[model samples]
Target: MSLHGLEEYLPSLVQFCLSVLRISLPLSLAAIAGFWSERSGTPQVGLEGFLLLGALAGATLVKLTDSMPMGFALTLMIGAAGGMLFYWLACRIAINAILVGLIFNLLIAGIAPFITKLIFGSTGSTPTLDPALRWQFFPYLWAAGILIVSLILFHRTGFGLLVKFAGLKPEVISSAGFSLSTVQMCSLILCGVISTSGGFILSTYLASCYSPMMSAGRGFMALAALIFARWDLPRTFAMAIAFGFFEAAQIYLQSVNSPLPSQFYQALPYLMTLVVLGLRRQGLSEMA
Candidate 1:
């Protein structure tokens, strides 16, 4: 608590905050993507697929073009296209949306290695990108900006209301003279576009290359946060930050000497997620 101690602690505190933001950025984005998808009545269980796709697109584009912005732009375009494909398969066809999402995840997982091999002559990952091409703090701004814009769009626009109706009451949307399927498709496409930023950050900001399975279940974690928050955008964001804090702690604990095994520390964030979800379910049961 002394002045010199405070000065030393200040740097550590700042670094921890930065760490949390870096860790949370992707989860937050994915949660928001899930928000849009589920809010519009489409299950987005394939968020993991989108995250991996983004990571691959971002690392590949940045390595090929050597421009971060260009890489990001192309990644978003790919995401939008992927979203359309998902809508066609899940919505347009007679299959169930959840099953379609699961199948999509499996399909992406199976092809990613082949895609990497075809593009980079490697079955594992894309080549490492230039560190200079990697983003640092700007991604935080981008995440924050996306969150704000999404909030505005969802709460302040008629489009948002239509999307909401598409989820909660399709009959209402139909009564309003808007095509229900159109609203759902648009929401899913936006979901795809937004979710890509998370993977882009994973490859461009957190690491230099796209590795296989780099998403490591963050997509599902984001979904849990979204569901726990009951599809509330702001609350989902907060849950993501909380998860990020646990992940940051896990990383920090690994760096310092500790009596516990490394796996325990590594599992800290996920364990925390399970705990939070359990608590939410318990709370709901009690209320019920």
Candidate 2:
């Protein structure tokens, strides 16, 4: 195309890129969380719970205190506390970690309404946030910063090596006289912190309020991205962005006139997910 034609396409391209980034923010963070948890040999099926709780806490605190920074600070604290609790239940108590994750998901789903009731005299949702108070692009910057820092840490630090070994060779860590539990706990805490930030964005930026089940399976999608990347951090993040692009396409398709029903457009992202996973599984089987 000529220069003028290219210029005509530039604005649409920019808008599409922004949409993908916005949709991917939460998924990318959650995928990073899964990377941390699973890299340390801890199964993190309860990421949905983390997202839900973070959304609720973020919306609640911001509504009560009217300070975004304070809301975020308190939300991270809550996430850390949640990490500790998960560690105690799944690690210290000697319960199966997967079972613990499942229980955590159910427990949070059941209790969120009561907590909302106590805080806002309502159940299953929080009050709407002010549009002026809501963020536009700052959270994307935060997510990108986190991705960069995590990449640096994973590639350039001993902690990253230790975490990698914690999953691949727990016996090595134990034989080396390092505390495996401590390593796992630290990873989990970071998992919690990062994943909750996704929820914060979901509640405050993506949506106006925290509603019941607001996570909408993005947590599981994030997990899928992690697995699809074979637990590689950079690959996991890239997969998340890919999924985000599919979602953005879905929304864009919905807006344009098409012969297909709206429901098909709504399910486009999920359908793409199944197709991608199926292809991956088939390729793995053939390799085997």
Candidate topping TM-score:
1
Worst 10 residues of 1 by lDDT: 279-288
TM-score of 2: 0.90
lDDT (10s digit) by residue, model 2, range 46-150: 899899888988999999999898999999999988888888887789798889889978998899899899988997899898888877668978998999988
Report, for every candidate in turn, its global Cα lDDT versus the true structure.
0.86, 0.85
TM-score of each: 0.91, 0.90
lDDT per residue for candidate 1 within 1-288, as digits (tens), equals 799999989999999998998888888999999899998888789899999989988998988888999989999999999889988988888478888879878988888899899988998789988776667578999899999999999999999999888877879988878898899889989999989888899888988899999998888888878877778899999989988887788778778876777677456556765776676635552211
Q: lDDT (0-100) at residue 39 of candidate 2?
A: 85
Clashing pairs in 2: none
RMSD of 2: 3.1
Instruction: Show pairs that collide, candidate 1.
Output: none
